[model samples]
Every structure is written in structure tokens, then in C-alpha cells.
Target: MKDDKLFTAYIKSAEHHFSGWDFSYITDTGRMQSELLPWSYGSMAATLVQNCDAFLDMGTGGGEFLSKLRPFPEVAWATEAYPPNVPIAAKRLEPLGVKVAQVEDDTTLPFDDNQFDVIINRHESYSPKEVRRIIKDGSIFLTQQVGGTDCIQINEALGVPANDEFAHWNLHFAAEELLQNGFKITYSNESYPAQRFYDIGALIYYLKAIPWQLEDFSVEKSLEKLYEIHTQIQSNGYFDVRQDRFVIKAEAI
Candidate 1:
């Protein structure tokens, strides 16, 4: 007999509305726990923008993190590619003197050459040549990217193949790209930190929020595998996965 109550709970979690790159629902409640990386991307971004005249935050989803970086530069601009997030970012950032623009292509940013003194990207895709063009000479381009192997355990558990599109993206690959595109790599780090889900509901919520993890994911389709995971969690108290992350700081030549 199936556990109807638990299944209903999981369904509700999967239906939950998530916005603005915020994972606080599960994180703050301790339902999902992710270990900290060795380096802090926010702190590094703050340091890079200090006393700088102009700054740009690539893929500023809902301006959540960017808005928190107070004491902005004279010209603070942010770009959001996702349509749903564009209005959210503009609403949150514009009032704070940060102009938020909707971007369609990462390769074609709406900015003049050498416009920004500092460019920061957090888990956002970018064209190396575009970054080099937008950033001033000797300026900084800091990015913390999600590695290609991020959270493979989930895919394995769900019997889904991992997304191979960016499977080659790693610290070395990113740094070398920057080196080839008129930038000098200054700092780089990579880590596979532990991530734990205390309940099946939280896992459902996570997969729902991050659609790229399993592009074809749906609760109905993965119900059996999800139930298997739920049983594992029930017996072990949590499901563990490793999060692949890498950071790069490069200076435009």
C-alpha cells in the first residue's frame, strides 16, 4: 500500500511557488543543508567593487544578492536574462539606484566597450569574449560557477542522465577560457561540498525550483524513484549529495 499522506505532502512541495533564486524556504528550515565553500563569492564581489566607478552584476536574478551589496558604485547595472526575473530584478534594484536591464544573449550585452570597472557573476553563464569586452582594461571579472557534475547523485537516484551540456565546465576550463580571451586568471578554486536533504518534500521542492537539474522532471513520472529516496531518507534520516562548485577571478588584459 502506498503512503497517501506522504505522497500528498510531496505533491504540495513540488507545487510550491519559488521565485528570485531564493532557497530560504528549505535552507532556513534546515530541511536542506549545503556545506559552505572555502571562498565567499559575495565577499569577493564586494571587495572587487569597492571604490570602483562602475559595476555590473551578470544574471542578477531578482536582484536578491546584488541589492544586498550596499554602497554601490556610481554606475551600478544589472542584467537578467530570464523574463520572469526581469521585472522582479528591476523592481528591487532600480529603487536602489541600480539599473536593471533585460538581456537576451550573453554574448551581446547592452553596454559599451570597457564600461564597467568590475563584473561579477554568480552561477551565471557568460561569453568569455563578451566579458572581456564589457570590462575595463585591468578591471576584475569574478564568477562562481556551478560545475558540470553538480548534484549527480540526484540524477542517479532518479534514474535520469545528468545534463551533459556543460559537463566540461570546471575550474581549469573556465580559467583557460579567460586566459585565451584577454584576461589573466588571478584566483580559482573548486570544491565538491556536501548537500543534504532531510525529507522527501524538500527534495521535491528543490527539483521543482531548479528545472535545469532534471529538465524533464515531474513528480508523477519520478514518483516511484522519489518514493525509493523517501524510504532511504526515512531509514537514514537524510539523503546526501555533493555539490560541485568552482570560482574564478580574472583581470582583463
Candidate 2:
């Protein structure tokens, strides 16, 4: 029954978002390929898999984390806020029996109380009230968030304002918020290592995809910025893109 609703939601969302042009390019362009976005997120979801079953992958973009979670064959359902995320994710998660929820509004999810054993979010934005209700006590809520100071250099190079207003790694604040709401954090891992990109074009595409970065949307401006990055990377071996991310595996009381 849950799976049925998920499919219905995904289709409805697709119908709504398909009104625009080819969104496939967002995830399927250039040498990078949108499909590979998940691996870069992290492989730490494996830790939760060994501990629980019946997973919920909120904001499961292109089902990238789902790729690493093949071992946990528990009943799995995914919720996505965007319709564009469905068709792209289906290619990776459909064969695995993962159903997609296509609801666009950001409300509490349509899950029963205490329904899932292991809840996962790879940058899925969820409300505190919603997460509190659906996740069971003793179950794990695993999140992979943008590292603090995620991509300041990229923004600076493009003359864009860089700040952590809504950018990634803001989850640490959110985690604290969840804690205040009666959750206990059992594990917290954060890393700030050098994440590299192949070339300048890839870096520019990354800028477009990453939220919270300044973008003029002007073709000429973006082109000029791209040229600058290209020259810089060509002079250097590759761009030293700083990747900051945090992992929190908390237990709901």
C-alpha cells in the first residue's frame, strides 16, 4: 500500500515538472554525468544498513545513496520533493523495489507513526515535526550533510558571495535543532578534505547544481567565469574543491 502511493506521487510530480524542457541534462550532461552525484555524497550510509532495516530515503536525488544500500533488502520507500528527481532516480532504484513519492509540497510525509527502522537523508530537507513522527524509537536517522565551508573558493572565483545561510553543512545547526526537540545524537562525523574535479567545465556545472552559491544566470557572465576557471585549472593540475560534510546517526526517543 505504501509502495502504491509512492508510485502515484512520482507520476503526478513528473506530470507537473515535465512542462519545462529537458531536465535530464541537469543530471545527465557532460563527462561527469548527473548519475554520479551520489557517490560523491559519501559511502557512510553502509553503517546504518548493518544496524537496521525498512529504510526511508528522503530527498533521494537520483537514488545515489540507494546504490550503496543494496545489501539492506528491507521494505524501502523514497520521498522526493521534486518531480524531476523521479525519472532520474528510477533508472537506479526501480529494480531494487524502491518506490518514489512525488509530492512537491513540503509537509509531513504520508507515513504511519514509527514506520521505518533506518531513515536516511542525503541532503534531503525534512521538517522537524515530520521526522519526529515517522521515525521509530531506537531506530537510526542517518544524514549526510554538506560540510561547513563547502565551496567558498568556487564562489569567490566567480565573484559570487559565499555564505552558509542555506548552503550545505548547515545540518549541524539542524542536528542541534533536532536534539532540542528530543533526539539523541549517538554518532557525529565531519570531514574537510580536498574534493577534486576533473576540469573547469565540470566545476561550473557543479556551481549550477550546488545551492546557496551566487549565480547571475547571465550567459555572458557565466561564460566569462567559466573561462577564468578553465585557465586556472589548466595552469594547475586540477581544482582543489573543498568538500565539507557531516554524518549524524541519531536515535529517536
Candidate 3:
């Protein structure tokens, strides 16, 4: 009882190319939307960047967000663990006097201890100890992370469990880890925002973009559930999911 045409279209949507951390194809088109968070991580980072002597952006995918924070300090560096994003980030950030490094291990970063005055991360993984070691005493580390329960509704609808490894990664656990690693949490906030998909295609594209959301995701495997969600959307006008997000500003002590 599958609608052949619709299934084919959803399958095709999953093939859409996603680069860096950009989701403009769906976000810009208004096909998918996530509600705004209470705090602005960008504004907070920009203020820090204005006064810092040395800055670092960890897990800077394609340097898309960092490039916008102009008027860089004398020493501005970005690191990307994903191989493909390193070149893209370099091409965009180097001309602006930002050096991009390809990093493999978060525990052992490339920089020297007490190197940066400020560090910013957006939805990137980091070792609390490494962050403390790299930043000078009294320096700041600001990060906006995707929490453990992020997009749980999507996984439930698709009949899959969320990634167990990151299931315990929430604001409380992260802040405690930072404190244990010689950081004092100065600011912290956690929120579950609503993300809506107006079409099945947008949902498929999102799943493809974030492979870790549903590790075994494949159009062939999820087609039936995708169709069910598609039908729900047809009836209800949209499919809504929850986004788990938290921001922390910790000072190295």
C-alpha cells in the first residue's frame, strides 16, 4: 500500500548534498524551521571576540559561523575534525587571517597549553580537560551543544532508539565535567526548541545531513515510516520534533 511516486521523491531528497554545517536548503526555503533559542551564542561569542588577544573556534565546520565574526584578533584559529570541512574552512577563513587546522583527536589538540584567551564551539564535541589546558587562566570557553534528547521524536516515529553513547550528555553532566576539569561555569542555559517539517522531503534531507541522529538510516529502510509521517503531514500540515540545545560559558580557573 505504498505510494510509489511519493516514496521515490523522498528517496531522491535524501541524496541532497549538505556541506559544512549549513542547512539553508531547507531552512531558507521555509520547508523546515526551528524555533529561536532564549540566548544568542553568536552575540555572546562576538562580544568575547572583540576584546580577546587570541581566539579559537573548535569544530568549525566550514568556518561558516566563525567567518561572520569579523575583526578577528591577531591570533585567530579554527579546528575541524571532519576531513572534508578542513579544506573548505581554510579556503574561506585563511584570506580573512584565520588559520584552520585539521584535528583528529579532541583529547590532544594541536595548540600549546594556555594559548587562547577565548574559545567558541557550536554543537561540537570537546574534552573538558583539553579545553581547560588550552585556554589561559581566566579565559573563557563558550559552547552551544546539542543535548542528548535532541530530535527524539524523529527517532521514535521512525521506530529507532537514540544514540546510547550520547544519551547522558545533558547540561548537568557537561557542567559538572567542566567543573571537575578546572573550569568554573559562569553562564549556562538549556532549552528544548520545537523543530517543524512542512514536508517529508525536508525531514529526509535532515536525516541524511545528520547521520548520527539515526545511524542506520537509509531511504529503503525508513521508506515505510517516512510514508507514514508523510501521510501525517498531509493531514496535520506539519510534523514537529524537539531539539535539545544547551549553552555554557565556562571560565578557566
Candidate 4:
């Protein structure tokens, strides 16, 4: 009966609305946590931004991360592909003089050729050709991508199929693609860090928020699996999984 009540509570908590790309609510609870990589993406972006005259932030969801790096260049722009996050990003960035544009997809950018001196993308998809067209000669492009195998254990535990669309997404492939697109790779690194879920609620919340984790994830459909995981957590105190991430820094030739 106690386990049943906990399950009910977790299911109800996971049904809340999640918007934008912010995961502060989950992270703050300390119920869901992931190990950090050795390199700091924010510091790297800040250093590059200080040297560039114009900058662009791709997939600047809710302008959460970009807004922190203040004293922006005279021209700063941001693009968000998710419809729900467009206005949220605009609201947070417009006052700071950042132009936020909504893009239907990552393949094409709505900017003119050689428009930006520095382009920063975090967990956003991009077209190599499109990036080459918008970045000025000798400009820099830095991106930290989420790898294909991130959190595969969750899918395995839930008995759901993993998304293999990005199976080839890694530091090597990304660097090669950028190099082929006329960019000289300067730095590349990849890491597999461990993530832990302290409770079933946190796991459900994460799967719900990150739909791609389990494309068709639902409490009703996965209740049996969820129950099994809940039992495991009860005995082990937490469930652990690995998270894949990679970073690349390149300069346009």
C-alpha cells in the first residue's frame, strides 16, 4: 500500500507542464543529477563572445543560458526551433538587445551570408552548409552536442526502442563534417558521464520533459516497467545511467 501511494504521487507529479529548455526545477530538487564534464562550455563561450563583434546563439531555449553572458556585442541574435520556446526566449532576450527568431528547422538559417563572427550552439542541431553560409570568414563556431547514446539505459529499462537517428553523432563525425564544410577544427572532446535518479518521480518527470528520451513514454503504458524500476530504486536508493556529450570548436577558413 505504501509503494502504491508513492507510485500514484509520482505519476501525478510527472503530469505537470514543462516548457522551454530549462531543467532547473528537476536539478534543484537534487532528485535528478548528472556528472559534469571537465571543460566548461559557458566559460569558453564567454571568452569567445568578448572577442567577437557579432554573435549568434542557436537553439537558445528561453534565453536561459545566453542571458547570463552579459555585455553582449553590438549585434547579437538567437534562434529557437521549438515553437513554444520562441516567445519565451524573446521575452527574456529582447530587453537585452538580442533579436530572437523562430526557425522551423535547423537546416536553414534566416540570416545573411557572413553575418556573425561567433556562433554558439548548445544541444541544437545545425546544418553544416547553413553554418558556413552565415559565418564570416575566419569566424569561430563552438557547439556542445548531446550524443546519440545518452541515457540508453532508461529506454532499456522501460522496454522502449532507442532513437538511432543520431547514432553517428559523435565528436569525430561532427568534427569531420565541420572540416568538410570549410571549417578548421581547433578542439574536440567527448565524455560519458553518469546520471542518477533518486526517485521514480524524477525519472518520470525527465522522460516526460525530454520526449525524445522515450518517444511514446506514458505512465499508463509503462506502469509495469515503472513499478519494477521503483522497486529497484527502493532497494538501491537510486538508479544510474550514462549520459553522452561532445564538444567541438572550429574556425571558418
Considering TM-score, where higher is better, how would the candidates rank from best to worst?
A: 1, 3, 4, 2
- For candidate 2, lDDT tens digit of each residue in 1-253? 2344532332233232331123343234432332123233345566665456677888877776576677655578887766777877776787778877766654658788888888888766667667778888877787777655776777776777777566544657868877986689987767665656545545544555554566454324665665656556567856666666666778888
How does candidate 1 fare on TM-score? 0.97
Model 4: pairs clashing at backbone N, Cα or C within 3 Å: none
What C-alpha root-mean-square deviation, in Å, does candidate 1 show against the real structure? 1.1
Q: For model 3, how does the per-residue alpha-carbon lDDT over 1-253 read when each residue is reduced to its tens digit? A: 2556865675677578999888998999998999999999999999998889999999999989999999999999999999988999999999999999999999999999999999999999999999998999999999999999999999999999989999999999999999999999999999999999998999999988889999978888977898899889989999999999999999999
By TM-score, is 2 or 3 better?
Answer: 3
Reference-based TM-score, model 2: 0.75
lDDT score, candidate 2, position 12: 36
Each candidate's lDDT (Cα)?
Answer: 0.91, 0.64, 0.93, 0.90
RMSD of each: 1.1, 10.9, 1.2, 1.3
Candidate 1 CA-lDDT value? 0.91
In model 1, the Cα lDDT at residue 164 comes to 88
Each model's TM-score, in the order given?
Answer: 0.97, 0.75, 0.97, 0.97
lDDT of 4: 0.90
Query: Residue 82 CA error for candidate 2 (Å)?
Result: 2.1
Deviation in angstroms for 250 in model 3?
Answer: 0.8
CA error at residue 235 for candidate 1, angstroms: 0.6
